[model samples]
Target: MIRQRVIVHGRVQAVGFRFSARVEAQRLGVSGWIRNRNDGAVEAEIEGEAASVDAMLAWLDEGPPGAEVTSLSTADLAPTGERGFRVLS
Candidate 1:
């Protein structure tokens, strides 16, 4: 399995980005959590098969139509061994 931490920037807050991320991650069979950052970005960690993870990253680009993702920075990481995807408080 591949694990990754992603920081998505640009028009991410107050636009259902986290909610959409959870739905998309579940749909893609990814496991992790997504949350809003103080810096006005969306942060998430996704773990799954490489293909699924890659697919999820691609979805992060457009992000629920309302999100205008200007950039996404991804880094390889060890899996947190999380159970499922969720929207973090």
Candidate 2:
């Protein structure tokens, strides 16, 4: 298993980015949570098979059609042992 924390920048907020991420993560069989940041970025922590996690990160780069992803920064992290994917408030 692999775990990562990612911060995505650009036209992410209020663009259904978090919700889209939740769906994508769930579809990929990943467990994590996504949320909006005050700095206008989207933040998420994903845990799953390495390939699935990597695929989700790649999808995050493009995001929803309305999103203009300018940057994505990810860091290796220990798994949180969470179940299911969700959107955080």
Candidate 3:
């Protein structure tokens, strides 16, 4: 398994981005957590199969229909072996 840290910017918070992420992550069988950053960005770290991680990242680019994802940044991370997607406060 692999891991990826994703930071999404622009009109992310209060747009159900984290909830959407939980849905997508569960659908893809990925495990990790997502939260809204103090700077109005949504950040998440996902760990799972390469294809699943890729799918989540791609979806994050657009996010839920209400989200206006202007930019996205991702970094490779060591696998955390996380299980079950979640929303962090």
lDDT of each: 0.93, 0.93, 0.93
Which residue pairs clash within candidate 2?
A: none
The segments of candidate 2 whose C-alpha lies over 4 angstroms from its true place after superposition are: none
lDDT tens digits, residue span 13-48, model 1: 999999988999999999999999999999999999
TM-score for all models, in order of appearance: 0.96, 0.96, 0.97
Write candidate 3's Cα lDDT for 1-89 as tens digits.
Answer: 99999999999988788998899999999999999999999999999999999999999999998899999999999997878999999
Candidate 2, overall lDDT?
Answer: 0.93
Judged by lDDT against the true structure, how good is candidate 1? 0.93
Cα lDDT of model 2 by residue, 1-89, tens digit? 88999999999998889888888998999998998989999999999999999999999999997999999999999987888998999
Superposed by TM-score, candidate 1 places the C-alpha of residue 78 at a distance from the truth, in angstroms, of 0.9
19 Cα displacement, candidate 3 (Å)? 0.5
Clashing pairs in 1: none
